[model samples]
Target: MPQFAELRRRVIQGGEAHFITSLTRCVRWAQRGGKSNAYFAKTRDDRFIIKSLNKAEKASFLRFAPAYFEHMVKMLSGQRTCLAKLLGVFTVTFKPTAGGGLSAATGSSSGPNEGLDLLVMENSFYGRP
Candidate 1:
């Protein structure tokens, strides 16, 4: 969470909107990829995709977040590119409920193996008809 706090600061300072995730409202409805070991889900509004990240992937993300953030800033602000913009990175603990919804995590006290690491990206085709 501290890392996210810092990331949020950097994102906003770089002229991008900061996205705060609500795991309670998101639904992980699909799994994708094989060797990549990635699962894909969308926000309830279908505006973003949440991708699961393994430990190594998460580490790589954090290591390059500064450069990635800058790349996103440029790509989103009129630069032409086929790359999807990363909206946020988060670690969340999801305890399943009877209705199949996730219980809210209270704080950042969860251990590394106890939570899900995720990358949030804008859905490039979200507005397509």
Candidate 2:
């Protein structure tokens, strides 16, 4: 997570996100229907989306982080690309629910799961030219 954070900082400083905000202040809304019955939401500013990831997706993101970072560097240098900017990768721990099973939509579990894998990216609704 820290590595990704550092990469994000470098890329943003390199000017890949001149239009991007600090993401320090925003609102969140819960939505439904995503991979592995995960949860999804958009920030109030419409600049970013926070989504839950299943184990496979989490693994894939970590596996591809190096390539993704490289691609962002290339794009930053004016190579032209279409990849979504990955802002952050994180985990949200949830306490077990009374039922002892994870909720398919919210990723909250009734004492059965430890946390939700999360991915944060630039919202597709904004920043297109």
Candidate 3:
């Protein structure tokens, strides 16, 4: 499996994610809207999508993650047509490196900062764009 560091590097290198080792599928850019950016990834096993929250809006999401997940579960349960589901909620932290670049970290930092929060979701091919 590719570690978070590797994934971060790929993202930073301008490589739009084409695959996710954890999900084990080829990912493609599906759609993006609102304050957060979204993408759809498809595979024979199942279609998945990932939503990356904007850095500026992390605080709002962090505050309501639990409530949002609960509501989603209720609304999406037992829906066969729904190819995507909520897998997990995690925080992707980024820090400014000494070289003036950014590094993707897994937790919050204590020093002065420049980082982002990302919300990952499985893509549902309900209405492919």
Candidate 4:
């Protein structure tokens, strides 16, 4: 995840703190005509966009992730590519608490407690005038 950390540090203002803070406050982002039932949310800080992906989409991305990192290293022209700067992909799940309650905190996105598969990318409109 060093490459991912590099991407985060390069594009964001701070480290993990900034990222967590950004996600702490987000608003539902409107759909711009996609055929999937994915959910979209824009960080209130306006630095990133979170898209919930289906199982199939998530699997597809994971399959080509190694190649993606390779290709990203070649993005040196400072121009936006067709694919936005994808920061990371992960799942956020809820875990059962000590009291047998589901915690709002994120956990493993797999297993019996299925969670959302998310794609976090740099906000295309970030830093816009």
Which one wins on lDDT?
4
C-alpha lDDT (0 to 100) for residue 49 of candidate 1? 79
Best by TM-score: 4
User: Model 4 over residues 13-50: C-alpha lDDT tens digits?
Assistant: 78768987888898999878887868999999899899
Q: Count the backbone clashes (under 3 Å) in each candidate.
A: 0, 5, 4, 0
lDDT of 2 by residue, 1-129 (tens): 565566566654434354245344555555655335567667666777777888888898889988888887787788887777888877766665567754443653334557777788877657666
For each candidate, the alpha-carbon lDDT, in order, equals: 0.66, 0.68, 0.49, 0.79
Q: Runs in model 2 with CA error above 4 Å?
A: 10-35, 97-113, 127-129
Ranking by lDDT: 4, 2, 1, 3
Residues forming the 10-long window of minimal summed lDDT in candidate 2:
13-22
Query: How do the predictions measure up, each by TM-score?
Result: 0.63, 0.64, 0.43, 0.78
lDDT tens per residue, model 1, 1-129: 344454445543333342443333577755545578588787776666789999999998889877766675675566777877676777777555567566766554333224788887767887699
Q: Which ten residues in a row have the lowest lDDT in candidate 1?
A: 14-23
Task: Spell out the clash pairs found in candidate 1.
Answer: none
Q: For candidate 2, give the lDDT of residue 101.
A: 52
Candidate 4 local lDDT, residue 124: 80
Better of 2 and 4 by lDDT: 4
**How far is 10's C-alpha from truth in model 3 (Å)?**
29
